[model samples]
Target: MSTVLQLVKRFREVLLDGVWIANTNFKDQLKDVTWKQAVIKAGSLNTIALLTFHIDYYIAGLIRVFEGGDLEIRDRYSFDLPPVESQEQWESLVNKLMSDAERFAVLLEQMPDTKMNEPFVAEKYGTYLRNIDGMIEHWYYHLGQITLIKKLLSSDLI
Candidate 1:
């Protein structure tokens, strides 16, 4: 398969549907999470809702750059999740994440293989491949945290 297609598949694996790596993707993990559960804090760890918003923040930002826009996302603002007080609000965030993830994969699949080696936005950001790989790794890191948080929330000890 082409490099771009491979990247798209890997991207989808983390955020959308594939389960080979983590045995669970964002869609599966967030499917049954209610707003209250999402917002419940596990010690000092970030809430599930905040993590969802954080990942989508980067994905949405990268999608803009892929579409020929500026890379405007900053790490400082990634976790600035608005209040998710109801099931509807939580679902909205999950829906946006899923949609942006799919869009990110689609945009990535359309990119030529040569473009992967090109700098992403600026040279400081590294190449497109690096950023994409970083995104996958980032999601997995949070996915692990979310998984543990969910487990913690479910246990009576929390």
Candidate 2:
């Protein structure tokens, strides 16, 4: 497989399953999470729901770029989650995360290897590979955080 294919494959793996370091991926970690659990603060930290939305927020931006739209996400507002006021809304958010992750990987699969080195939105942001691979890294980072939060929640340690 080409490097581009490898990057996209790695992204899916880290987001969905079989990450080398952490035992859980974003999708698996979120399994069976209730809105009440998701909204739990677990001390002063961000809620699981907030973290989930934050990770997807940037991924959605990259997905937009892949779909020929501009990247319009801002870091300041990344953690701004919609109200998970009901069970259905929580389920909807998780479903959106799954669908969006798949959509992003599919889009990346179609990109030519050469395009990976091209500017992502702008030259200042660096290459497409950097931005896309960065998303995978970002997701993995938050996956660990979510795991810890869940662990704490279950352990009654918080």
Name the top lDDT candidate.
1
Cα error of candidate 1 at position 105, Å: 0.8
**Model 2: per-residue Cα lDDT over 1-158, one tens digit each:** 98789997788887876667676688888987998999999888889999989988888888887898988999999988878898888888888888898898888899899998899888899998888788778778888888889989899587
Task: Show the lowest summed lDDT stretch of 10 residues, model 2.
Answer: 16-25
Residue 147, model 2: Cα distance from true site in angstroms: 0.3
Candidate 1, residues 6-107, lDDT tens digits: the string is: 889988998888889999999999999999999999889999999999999999999999999999999999999988889999999999999999898889
What clash count goes with each model?
0, 0
How well does candidate 2 match the true structure in TM-score terms? 0.95
Clashes of 1: 0
- Model 2, runs deviating above 4 Å: none
Q: In model 2, what is the error at residue 48, expressed in angstroms?
A: 0.5
What are the runs in model 1 whose C-alpha is more than 4 Å off? none
